[model samples]
Structure formats: structure tokens, C-alpha cells
Target: MKPARKLFLGARLRRLRRDLKLKQVDMAGKLGISASYLNHLERNQRPVTATVLLRLAETFDINVRQFAAEGGELAGPDQLSEIFSDALFADLDIGRQDILDLSDHSPGIAEAIGRLYTTLTETARRQSPSDTSDPRSLITPETWVRDHIQAHRNHFPALEEAAETVGGALANRLTMIDTLCHRLRDAFGVNVEIASSTDLGGATQAYDRSRRTLFLNALLRPENRAFGLAYQLSLLEFDAILTRMVQEAAPSDEGVARLLHMSLANYAAGAILMPYGRFLESAERHGYALDPLCGEYNVNVEQVAHRLTTMGRTGAEGVPFFMLRVDPAGNVSKRYAGESFPFSHYGGTCPRWLLHLAFQTPGKTITQLIETPDGERYFTFCRTIERPIRPTLTDDHLLAIGVGCHVRHASRLAYAEGLDLAKGMATPVGPACAICPRLDCAYRATPPAGHQLAIDETRKTISPYPFLAD
Candidate 1:
């Protein structure tokens, strides 16, 4: 038989034993091996045979393949190879064996260098504006959305159903808000106490550790109070269900997975308040109207808009919706989509879209059909809602929140209908910064860094122009 391949198995076994807080004598006794032999094996002075390997497997009750395979431990050569292959270290000229020695002996240093490289890359991506000249692009918004969706595999049927049912039940009852609060307290064993600012003492929702109860400040607007109650209930009741959904999705990217976890938690809260089937039924019944949904659910315009976009819960999926919320200064606060919405990589939003005009009519809602320069048309509605900064506290400030959705899904909405979205009514929209190159755009903030700019001082084009090469 071939000489038993050692392959660092003995060292791994020794480490595992030490980790389990077992001594050499104890390990040897358990394995039916002499202490001297075990010592020799651990020190790499002797190779482990099949008999000892089998005994170790039996004792640990683990698969032999896992023990044989490098269990989170990398060898000197493997570590060195990874370091050498790293893009940041491509310029470094070092001997192979030397790199291996450093990796084996000074893994901490290697890890530090790797982290530094990652940090530098991230910083560069964030700071660089021009995409034409810069090679490393920060994660695109579309990619981010895609990853978020993939992480959850678009499974949230429970949330959709919940949002629909709860939304409908709250439609007709003036005491519905009180009833829902009672249900939350009864189901979750948590009291729903709405006290004044003095009672809450500056906290929006205070969780009393001793009493094991929650206190909501009464200063919050009616809509916000309902949302807060539902959000808390979601944490209490649906956390395990959300966890199982994420686990089933099995996200590959760590960052995306973390975001998805947070997003799902938020979704569960919204669903608990809105309930999918009822919400959908209500939307259809109300002719996709926002005002009635808000009054019915005791939620704000923004909350209703957000909840509407999340109707993509499995079987009873609503028309694939894309939602975007931007401030008056063109800062995007929230963006979620069931359909792909092309976003700019760099600076200001497309000027032609009603999102900009919505700010002009702050409290009023405007519905419009938007078509991008690339001929992608969407039915969009824009409106601003005042959100209290500190809902339950005295220091609360009212901030205007903007909300919009894709136009194709607008027929079901109560907003302006019978508008021809397909008749090319939308103006072209492009990325705000160096990422988009619409030559005729009057609102182009900066020339796309990726394109070559030809400045002719004598002949200024209508737009801050860049030369399109053949």
C-alpha cells in the first residue's frame, strides 16, 4: 500500500484536540495510541496511518473527507500562491519560496496587506467620477438591486399576503388602528403604550428592559404610529420566518446577504401592516389610488408607495414595479424595483422626469409617462410627503419625502389614468455624472469621464459637449 499520506492531518488533529481542551495523554488514550506516537504524529515527526485516521474519525463522529480536506487551514504554498495572484501585488517581484515562507510564518502581515489593498480599491472607486478613464467602478446601483433580489430569490409571499389583508381590514374601521394595536400586543405579549414626549424622554420607541415592554411617544403622527407598531410586531413574530427565507435563498455575496437580511426584516414589518392580498385587492378596488390606501391603512403617501412596490411576493405578484425616492436636491434616499430601472453611475438625475417637477409642487401629486433617451418608457407618479424626523420626540422636524413608480404599472393606480405612456410622452433620462452621455441634455452636470471632451471656446454647443468619435 502507498505510504499513508500525511498531508498535515496530524497537525490538524492535534489542533482540533487542543481546541477541544484535551491533553495529549487524554487524546492518545481515547484514540488507543501511545502518547509518544501521538506526540510524534502531532510534531510532524511521523505520518498518520489509516488505522489512526479511522479512529480519529470514529471518535469525532465526523466524515473522513472533511478531516482530510484542509478544514479552513491553508498551507504555506497555498497562501503564498493566493498572495502572488492578488491584483494589488502584481507589480511585486519576489521569489516563490520566499513568499511561501512569509505566508507560512507571518500570515498576520499577509492579511493586513490584503485588507489595505481592498480598502484602497474601495476608496478609489468611490472618489473617481469619470468612468471612461477609471477602470474600477464602484458597485453599480443596478447590480446592487440585482444582488439584493437574488439574495432573497424574490420569495416573500407571507409579507405580500399580510400587507394585503391588513391594509383592507384597516380600510373601513375608524377604530381599526386601535384594534390592530391591541392585536399586536395580544399576539406578541408586548404592551402598546403611547405616551407623550415627557413620558418617552426623547426616545421614539423605548424598550424598558425591566418591564419588558415598549413605549411609543404620542407626538408621532397617526400614520407613523401604526407603522411603528407593525414594525415592532414583525420583529417579534416574523423574525424566524424571515431568517428561514434568507437561509433558503443561500446568498453567495456576504454584503448582499447582509443587506437582504435587513431588507427582508423591513419587508416583514411592512407586510404585517399592509398584508398583500388585501392591499392588492384594495388597490384594484380603489383604482390604484394612493390617498385612500394611506387613509385606509393609516399610513403616509411614502409608506403606501414603498409598500406598493413590495407586492412581488410569489404567486400573487403585482405588476413588476420600480420605486425611487429622491430629495429636492436630487439625493436618492430609497430605491427598490421589481423591474430593471437603469440608473446613472455618477451625478444628478435626469431633468426631464417629473421627479424634479414634483418638488416644485411639494404637497401635490403628479403622474407622468417618462421615456429615457434609450427609448425605455415607464409610467411614473411623483408626490412629496412630510415625514417627521423625530416622530415621538419634541425635536422632531418635518422633512418632505418624494415617491414615484414605473408607469407601465400605473393603470391599477388611482392617480391620473388614460394617459398614453406608450405614445412616447417621456423625456430622455441619463445618469447624473460622467457615466451618461446625452449630448442634448441641458441639465448635464458634468461631462462623462469615459468620453473624450473637445472644448471649442468659440463654438459652444447647446450642452456642455463631448466629442462622439467614429
Candidate 2:
């Protein structure tokens, strides 16, 4: 028989303990081990036994396979390799073992370095003529809000509970909109009115607190108007809850705080409209068909896509999905994830991904299997969605929304039906062009940041900018 391989899961165990918010002693007691022994296991001084691994899986409700996997989404060796491959770090002698040690032992510092590098590259790409030395200057309110939302895996339990309560009260009504309008008037003495696009001056919805009237743009679709009402109702019903959550997010800038407040309210609105438990049941029963769910819930495509990312309610969790919304110009306006998608933290996403191609076929749903450079595969579906109409907006303002999950979960999707997932060829994609190491891609927009171009007068290559392999 072949010898059994040893399992050194120090880093993963430590990260799990931190995620559970447990002290070393507390975890040790639960594991029926001494704190010193647990410390040794966490520091890689001892290999984890099979019995101990199973105990951990049962104790914490974690996946044994995922916990035993090397590296992680945030501090993976691939991410560190990409960051160090930049020309700015060319002077430093960073070996593979050195990167491995940093990623395994001090993952937090590795992730922090990755974030700083991303901020630096983003600042440079924009050619911001201001201070380029301090990368922190490039951190915008949106970045802060995005990071905060991602930290929670896009789930807010406090808002979810409040939404469920509100949803119960609105049940058995004639129509959601009528009930919402009546609630606004009876509960809060706030009248709802549909105003012309010209009257709103290009805003989708406006609240006049002094007049106690909510003016919604008439051009909005029925679903959006309902959503606007739910959003306003959430603000009124859960002011203290939203305020507390915003304070917990602790964004330094007031702009970031306000953005977070609005985001929380949006979460509440989705929960109130969809009502978590019923939505999850419907999603599973229907194989997560977006259109069917949208029709059943009276919501739009974008709202359904966003709600899918927030199904992390523990014990009733749905397949982890990451969603991205981008305009025709390649600008990503919204992103939420329950699973890591390796999004471009610095520059534009890879052109080969289906999200960009979704713009080519308007109103049509498209699906593709993509493999990141790290060899992780995902099943993706994308479609064009119409945004709420504004007076300044024209027909050209269409956006593409893409939702995806790991290939392991592909079988659960209706869109993945009749597809050979095990043998399907996946399109290879990079997180971004500058950090990509693939020299054979003909569509590469930029050379790898730190690699040397193999310029030769005698030979032409298929790739426009071929570089020497590391």
C-alpha cells in the first residue's frame, strides 16, 4: 500500500477559529484537546490526525474538503504571486517558498499587501494627477463600501429578521404595491405619488420628508416602483436597525456611511419582498431559474440577481454565488459575492468572460464555463437588464448582469441542464490583463506587468505582445 500523506492544516484551522470568533482556549476545549496541543497544530508543529479533522468538521459545520484545501480565496498563493510579479517589486528577491510561507503563516499581511498593490495600480491606471505616492488616497467611498459588504458575504441577519417580520404583516394583501402604499399612508402618514419624469428632474425616486410624500418616477417599471416603495418602507420601519448596521460597518467617511446606509436599506427591501425562506425554497424548487423566480416574486432581473448573493442564512444556505453588473463601457457598477470570484481589484476584468459578451446579445441569457488561471472552474450565466428609467437616460443605458458559482454547484442550476459539466471545455480567463501570466492569449490588451517582452525582428507571433515565460 502507498504511504498515507500527512496533513498539515495549521493555517486553515487558525482561519476557521478566527472566523468563528473563538479564542484558542475555547476552541481547544471544544475539540477536547489542550490549548498547547492546539497551538502546535495551528503553528504546523504537528500534523492533523484524521480523527481530529472529522471532529473539526462536525464541531463547526465546515466542509472537510474545503478546510483541508491549500490556500484560500483572500490570501491564496496565486494572488500573492500576481502581486509580487509586478515590476515595482522586481528588485526584491521573492522566491516561491517565501511566497508560500507568507501566504500560509501570515495571510493577513499578505492580503493587506495585495490590497495596497491593488490601490496603487488602480490609481496609476486612472492617471490621477494628484498624489500617487500614498495608495490610501485612491481608496474611494465605493471601495470602502464594497469591501465592507464583501466582508459579510453580502448577508445581514439583523435586516433579514426585521424583513421577515415586515413581510408577515404585508401578507394576504390585494397587491404588494397597494399594500405598501396603504402601509406608507396608514402606518407613517406618508402618501405615495407617481410623478412624471420631468417633475423628478432625472432622479428615480425622491422623498419629501417635510411634506410626507414619496414621489416615484412614472417611467419606472412596475417591479421597480414596488421596490422603491419597499425601500422607502424599509427606511421608515428599520431606521434604528440600519443606523446600527452602518455604525458597525464603521466607514470613516460620511459619504461611505451614507452609501452603506442605503445599501442596508436595499437589502432590507429585497428581504421584505422575497422573504428569505420562501425565496430559498422557490429557488431550489425551480433550479434557480431567474425568469421564473422574477415572475413569481414580481421583481426584476437585477433585484433577483442581487438577492441570490444574500442567501447565506446559515443552515438554510443556498449555492454560493457571485454577481457582477457592468455597463457597455466595461465599467463595473455593482458587485456582490457569497463566494470569491477573483474580481479585478485594480483594473478591468478579463475580456474573455461572458459578462462582457452579454452586451452583444441583448435580452438573451448566456451561459459559459470559465476556468481562472488558478485552475478553479465556475459556471456563469449572463443577461442584459434594463435599469430604472431617468429623464437623462436613453435606450443606450442597458447593463449586463452576470451571476455564477463554482462548477461543483453547476448541477443545481436550470441553465446548466443538458450540459456535460465534467468534460465541458472551459474558457481560460485571468482576473485582469496586467497581472495575467498567459503569454499565448491573442486578445491580451497589455503585457504582463513584470515580464520581459521577447521582441524579435526575425519572427512574428500569434499573440501581439508575447513575453518570456518566468
Candidate 3:
């Protein structure tokens, strides 16, 4: 055919060779071809035939179509072009081809650029107060929730199946925590005792490295005890599996990756305790109700919700859920999810949602449907939980925290059946005024930092709230 057509295969082959970190001589030897002949093929001096392509595929354990397509690849250039177009690079003096070349030749540079961009963005957000007010601001609270969910790919079929299987046995045992304690004693011969008043100075769960004994604090709530037991069990049963999963997840942040590793280990422990199939059946039988599920498992609302997101493990998968833990001032401490939820880079922005209102009605579950300016709707449930700061001391105080989740998949919940979701509907809320374009909001605290404000002495519009457009 034409010279251009011939060159396509050559370029793809070159790209693949580089991606595999293979040298020309090594690849030529594997293909039983001369280095000179391979070089000619890569330069489009010779066309790659079907038989050669098949042989290459067999040798590399790749598909024949993939081998053939690699000979004349166009995908890499397109992807490189897209990466260079990112807003982070908008002000930088760079060309699309330069980015492609860098990505092809030096992936490290591209990754460095990404990290730098993230750091700079974070700095900008912290410096500007108005940035915090914009519901659409990149640093809003929803970002953390979204990232946690994205990290897990919103799937946990194994955990769900395990919960269903052990849920019934756990239901009758007074508490999942108690059942786990018993399991520890039976399986490992480790007697788990909550520490009494005299033992208050020691660690909550201390493993006598010398005696091989395990001691747990007696004062811990049932859920916390169960979680501790499961966490310990994970270290014994699935350390290698957890390591493998962490490696596969390839988290960008070391802290987050470490947390994910520990979380997965705990998840494995929970799976071993509950098993997947039984939990799924119980969840379905119970109509996916939170209170019943929590009672059945001797867990709390937050724990139940956290476990619900893990139910994607087996045949009975539920809608992916995202969970967040935030304080009164809108600071998020923890977030986990099984689906992609959009928010700013930092946290969630939508302020009008029940999550914000839940702060006003402390110690109660607030349910509401929130709609964003973009018309995306989410059903949300929120409530506050308290934990004492110091359990051993008589004067120890309690800290109140709010936990929330979206109802995108709440149809299976027993509590969701009779609720009227449409009446007196309030529009979804966003984080702050800076990022949110809703100019008419009565809650606008200050003008967006980067936006210019308009002044009108003649007349005033109710909603235009005079912010100068940048």
C-alpha cells in the first residue's frame, strides 16, 4: 500500500516495544528474526505479515489482534494529546507533541507534573478564604468522599457475601463483637478479655509478644471491639492477600495506601467472620434495613452503612454507596465509597443537603433529597454519633461527629419503601458560595475570592448578588 500506511504498523510496534521495556535485539531474538530485519520492520521498510503477527502474539502471550494493531498504533498519540490538554498545563508553555514525547519517553516527568499540579492547587485553595465557600470549589468536602470511593472502584462483592452468611449467627449472638471474640478464642485459642478498671493503663488490645496472649479493653463498645477483633484476625489470616490488593490498587498517596491496606485487612477479617452468602441472604430477607441490620449484627449505624458499601462482593450486589464522616464546622475526617461521586478536589460543596442540616438536629437521623445545580439528584441520610474522648477517666468528655451517605441505591432498604421523596422538595446544596454559581442564595457569606463584585446604586436585583466576573 502507501508509505504512510506501512509506517503505521512500525510505529505501533516501536511503542509496544518501549512499553514492555524490551530492546530491539531481545525482541528480534524471541521472534527468530535478525536485528536488522526487526529494525527495518519498525521503520516501515518492511510490512508485518499475519503469520509473523500471530507468532509474536503466541510468544508474548498476547492477542493476535493486539499484536497486529500495535504495528500501526494511533492510540498512544491520542491519549498523550488528551493528557496535555489538562487545565493544569493550560498556562504552561508546552505543545501537544512535546507532552506525547515526554509521556512516551519519560513517564516520570509526567507523573511529577501531576503531583506538582495537585500541590499547587491545594496551596491556592488554602490561601483563599472564598475558595472554601464555593460549592464547586476544587477543595470542597465531596472531593475526599469521591476519592475514597474511586480508590476502591466501588466494588466489594466478597465483603457483602460474607456479611450475609454470618449475619444470622451474628444476629442471635447479642453482638457481632461478641461473636468475633468467641471466634478468636475458638480458632486461635486467644482469650480476648476487655480490660477492667485496674488494667486501664495498658493498650486497648495488647498482644504479649512474649506470652502470645491477646488482651482487649472491656470498656470499648461492641462495634469497636468487633472491629478490633477483625483487624487482629486479618493480620493472622490474610496478610499476603491484603498486600497483593494494596499493590494492585496502586494508591498515589502513601498515607491513603497504608490506610487502604489496613482497611482491606479488616474487610477480610469481617468476611471471615460473616462469610458472604449468608450476609447477602440476611440483607435481602431483612429488606436491607439499617436498624435491623445493625441490631442483627450488634453494630452501629455508621458501621452498618460502612458494611453496606462492602456488599458488592457476591451475587446479591447493591447500588454503590459513598460514605463520609464530617464534623460541625464541615471538616471531613473519613470517607469511603464504592462508586464515583463528583465533588471538588478537596471535599463536598453541596451545602443545602441534609448533611449540613443534620448538624442543627443533633442525635437524630435526617433524610432528604438533594439536587445540584447541574440537576444531579441524591437521596441522603445523616445522623450524629458520639464517642468519649477518654474512656478510663471519670471526667472524660464526648465528641460528637456526623456521618452521612447518599441514597442512590436505597431502594433495597426497608426504611426506603414508604418515604415520600418528592413532596416539599428542597434543591440539593453545595459546599460554599465561591464555587457555587447560585447568585440568589440567601446564605452567601462573602463574594468568591477570584470573582469581581458589581456595584449598582440605581437598582438592586434580588438574586444577582453582585460578584464581579473574572
User: Considering every candidate listed, which one attains the maximal lDDT?
Assistant: 2
lDDT (0-100) at residue 73 of candidate 3?
A: 28
Order by lDDT, highest first: 2, 1, 3
In the range 1-470, model 2's lDDT, one tens digit per residue, is 65754666676788779868999999999999999999989887788898898889778876565456453345567667777767778778576668877766665677688777767765665665364454454666687787778766788888998998898788553399998999999999999999988888878999998999999999998899999999999999999999988886666666668988998898999999999898899999999989999988899999999999999875788988899898899888998888767777556678888888887899899999998886789999999998788445346768999899999999999999998887899999887787787778988887776677997889988778898886
Query: Would you list the C-alpha lDDT of every candidate in the order shown?
Result: 0.60, 0.82, 0.56
lDDT of 1 by residue, 1-470 (tens): 55533454554666679657999999999999999989877765666677887898788664454355421233333333433444445456445557545544444455455444433545566775334232223444334444445223233566555555555455344565576677666776677777777777666667665675778877777777766776676666667766776676565455545666667766766776667777778877887677898877667787877777666543465665556667666777665555445543223356777676766676687766766554567776677767543543463233333334456566666664666656745666654544454666676766544345778888888777655631
The per-prediction tally of clashing pairs is 27, 0, 48
Of the pair 2 and 3, which is ahead by lDDT? 2
Candidate 3 structure lDDT: 0.56
Off by over 4 Å in 1: 1-155, 161-173, 196-201, 246-262, 345-348, 389-408
Error of 1 at 306 (Å): 0.5
Give candidate 3 regions above 4 Å deviation: 1-114, 121-149, 154-172, 175-179, 196-203, 249-258, 270-275, 285-287, 347-349, 388-410, 419-424, 449-452, 457-465, 468-470
Candidate 3 local Cα displacement, residue 127, angstroms = 15
Clashing pairs in 2: none
